[model samples]
Target chain A: MKVIKITAVWCSACLIMNKRWKEIEKDYDVETISYDLDFDEDEVKEYEVGEKLPVFIFLDGDKEIGRLIGEKSLEEIKKYIEELN
Target chain B: MKKLLKYILVFLFFFCFLVNVNAKEKVTLYFFHGDGCPHCAAETTELIKDLEKRDDIKVVKYEVWHNQENSAFLDKVMAVYKTKTGIPYNVIGDTAIVGYNEANKFEIERALEYYKEHNDKYRDVVKLIKEGKEVKINDHYSKQDDKTDKDTTITIPFIGEFNVKNISVGSAAVLIGLVDGFNPCAMWVLLFLITALIGLKNRKRMILLGSIFLLTSGLVYFLIMFSWLNIIISVSTSILFRTLIGLFAIGAGIYNLYAYIKNRNQDDGCDVVDEKKRKTIISRIKKFTREKSLIIAILGIMALAISVNIVELLCSAGLPLVFSELLAINNITGMKAVVYDLIYVIFFMLDDFIVFFIAVKTMDVIGFSTKINKYSHLIGGIIMLLLGILLIFAPGIIMFNF
Candidate 1:
């Protein structure tokens, strides 16, 4: 499974996720990519991301499946990943 | 022949001095009196006799009781001066005498002399009276133009020539500011702050943090307005800028409407701030609380407030953009522009103020914020949608004069 994280440097919430993302990478055997809303406009547009930041899109080989927004615990995310697999 | 010429030249010099004195010394007294009032009649008689003996006093009588025009003129004048309601009213230069009596004779004489001595203040008003033009004490009051059956238009300081239309530019600024005040981006930041601070169970900390946050938001908003003002004033005439603003409004409107539709039945409301961001915000706030000192936490929050503006702009920039653009287009400037911007900021912060007050005073802010969070999307969506349509299709409705 692959995860796309949408974020911005100015967003405190996004910064929090950035720290968590590093931990998530260490724990999970999943590919992760973080996109900044300010500079990565092309990717943001391509993925149909809105103004909200710190969004995680779970993808199954380029096929968009589910999305999580705001703050969710690492355990809950792992549960979702397990369920998806 | 030389002796005759010298006598003639001395006579001419004396004559010129007398003419100059007459021109500079005469003072006009505007007497608004009721025709049938015995006191007014007596005062008029006494005034006429006094005027016959003196060459410096000029009386301009308006019978308030008999003539509609005179009555209206008197009302206008009284309104301007905010004087006591009465007939027998007298205005000489800057001084006003409310009633006539034995004691007031001295006042009348003194005012006449005072006006003659300082005629500059009353020169324009007196000229307007002489020309049968309404004395403009208040700019908002309309004057009827008999030629067109419309209100006589005057060139207002910032808004150019007065257009007799639905709303004035000043009023439009207020309305747009009101709408912009309800912006969801601001709401998101405020709610996040309240919720974060409330969890600590410290009312003092909450109040301190909330205050710093709000103060910073207000300051940043004001600075942004100044920047927008400069841009608008310098390049307001460009049609492309207006067109871009119109397009931006439309885009923002559609986005909000879409959010509303998607989240109509959902309890979470608009997902402008995704869950990951919300969690991150919570974590950061927790970090702040864990700071070694409360003062450091507060200072950290202030910095947080400033940084939040950039992210908030993504969702809330539309309304302010439209408002500032309209202000620029209307040519509102100088202190007037500053006043309008102040009004805008006041209204914009009103919601935050209310929430902060509730949170700090009650210390139960999280539940209240949660309840409001439910309807934020729908309300913001509808308002933005309507405003957006107005901007794209008929900006004149929002701005009054396009």
Candidate 2:
């Protein structure tokens, strides 16, 4: 599965979750695409992200599957990934 | 042997002459002044123009009122001096003269003489400033420095001349208050309260309940600031406490600055209040606006105001705290400090007033544009950073204005 991560420079939650995202990539063998809300606005707009920041979109190929908003703990993120699988 | 002795005596004579020339070199005196200010203008057209004739002093002029770059450079100079922010400020050698007068002119000359007498080579502060080099404040300069910033003195038709401290402190209060009012945390609560009030179709009840709610919020804010003022005053003497507070301001400043950049493309929002707490507040608001009795409704409104203010303080980005600390450090105590805090709260409630008044008049609920909050955060962040740096490094200097 591929995950599209939308983050911003000012979002503390987003910064905190970045290391966890790396760990998740190693554990689940997933490809990740990261986009900054400001610098990558054109690409981020295609996903229609919500008000809150640090969005993670789980995808199969180019088609979207599910997404999560805000800061999720390691266990919760892992569980969500497992559920998606 | 006689011819060799003559050559050595001649060499020593020229060497001493060179060292004396270096010590008494033509010194560059940096004069930063504003155009419209009377004292500075007179100093420029009269004193500076006269000083230009002197061979030993080089007068470098910077008109700060119209020039942005010069104004910024002025701030850099004042920050280095660790002195109060005011114009008509003069810097030469290691000496800085803040306000200008007949007596200060003599003091300037004396400073020139002192630096010429004390060292073999004079330190050109203006050159150091231009080079962006770190200029150290000399202890001898500090001790002999009786020309510290006197603050800008203003003249009135009836009042004659007076210090500009009150005006500066008042302006700071207003500016800080307005920024604090744009706080997203409190704005959300006010919007929610407005929505609940609109549920009451009765105009009289809506106005009464809304006004009381605003009053309670203002009162709570005042008390909070006053408490901080007392606490800061108690610990104001401690260097460690002052430094810590300065560091906290700097930290909060960085957080706000990062927030400004992070939300550049995003909307103004409250990330502090979670979904659970939000739902609870919504339920409480609904219950308050639906109360059967008048007294119970008023009590409910007060309760909502209290709780909302508490939450706002938690996420207010330290505007009120910084303001109270300013008053504490400046030694503005008793009734005078209370008056300043009152002025702050009144302005802090300005947005709420405008929103409520408009909603009551037109029967439409509206809030300030999201852009305003974004800009306020940017400005607030910068001001906090400057104040924090000044507070940490220049504690003894009386801060009149930024």
Candidate 3:
């Protein structure tokens, strides 16, 4: 499973969530790809997020599984991932 | 040997004389200020700025409300010197100077000169402490000397590693929360909740359900606002941000003032209502409970409450942002951020609960009619206006020069 976490330098919520995601990834078969939204315009467009940074797009074998936006709890993200599986 | 002893005695006499002439008087200047008083705030700022420039004098500031002795003294001073209002008053030696005018400055200078004249008396007192000698402080010196031997000698317990940024940010968040909770705008929500509860047939259930609903609504409001705090702080310095906040506050204030005026006009004209009409209104409200589900009704009430003060909420959202930004720069960790947010939300809800209960009790005592329950809207509006004004002017008014 490929979990691409797109965020900016100044996005504090993203940084905090990223820290939690790192801990969670240690237990799951998750490949996390982080990108700076300010610089990576092509990556942001690829995710279909119009100017919205700090969005998590979960992909399972080239198919888009789910996407979560805004500041979400680790539990909420975990639940979303579990439902996808 | 006798000649050598005489020479040493002369040298000792000359050394003592030089020490007396060169001794610096340790003058402790104390300033007291209030939270809301503009003049007091200005005086304190000026005094602080002035003290920073002077190495010879030291200023000890005590917020009147926070300090028991200062508060008591302030009360006494208020009673004794009726003309002396606001802060930055200087109590030098025996005299007091109120305001930051030239006259006050001259008076303060005179007092300082008098203190210098009698500097020899206090010199021994200060010297004893400096020399590590046990000095008994009498009442005369104690009144002027804000610092005692114990104060200078005792070491305060260090709670954590000293971090300036953390402390500043933490304090700013707390201050913002306090200001938000205290805002008159929040008062109206409490008023409406109380009136609505009292109007309900099942008073106990209504109170409980209403409190829960209001608390939940408050939580939702807090979370939404807290989440947006970082965004606000990130872009706070922008002109667009300032204008949005300013306009929102002013607009809310105007709306509230209009509502209050309209309500006042209605109250003056209406004295009697037909019994049938009153009964119909009561029946309609009663139907709300019988026909609608409790969960739906709670949601409906929450929606109604939130809708009425949407502007106020928007304005308050700015506070958390300002606070969070201030905190974030101080390296406030994720855990501390959660704790600070929780504290703010809890305090905010508690304040609402208190105001709600008070308004309910007041209405009950006065025996306000069910038909006039809508008057709570007017109260809420007035609170909004006051809060808007406070938000708009508080910082500037507080820092105004005397």
Top-scoring candidate (TM-score): 2
Badly placed stretches (over 4 Å) of model 3 are A1-85, B1-167, B232-292, B315-317, B358-402
TM-score of 2: 0.53
lDDT of 1 by residue, B87-191 (tens): 467777645665565545556776677666666544435446557676554321121112221233467888887545324655655655665666556565676
DockQ in order: 0.08, 0.02, 0.01
Chain A TM-score relative to the true structure, per candidate:
0.85, 0.96, 0.86
Clashing pairs in 3: B40-B87
lDDT for each candidate structure: 0.63, 0.75, 0.51
Q: Rank the candidates by DockQ, best first.
A: 1, 2, 3
B350: Cα error in model 3, Å: 4.3
Alpha-carbon DockQ of candidate 3:
0.01
TM-score of chain B of each: 0.51, 0.60, 0.37
Which pairs of residues clash in candidate 2, taking residues 3 or more apart in a chain or in different chains?
none
Error of 3 at B354 (Å): 1.1
- Tens-place lDDT per residue, model 3, B276-310, is 54344334334443445777666655655465346
RMSD, candidate 2, Å: 17.8
CAPRI-wise, candidate 3 is incorrect
Instruction: State every prediction's TM-score relative to the real structure.
Output: 0.45, 0.53, 0.32
Say which prediction, candidate 1 or candidate 3, comes out ahead on DockQ: 1
TM-score-best of 1 and 2:
2
True contacts kept of 3: 0.00
Better of 2 and 3 by lDDT: 2
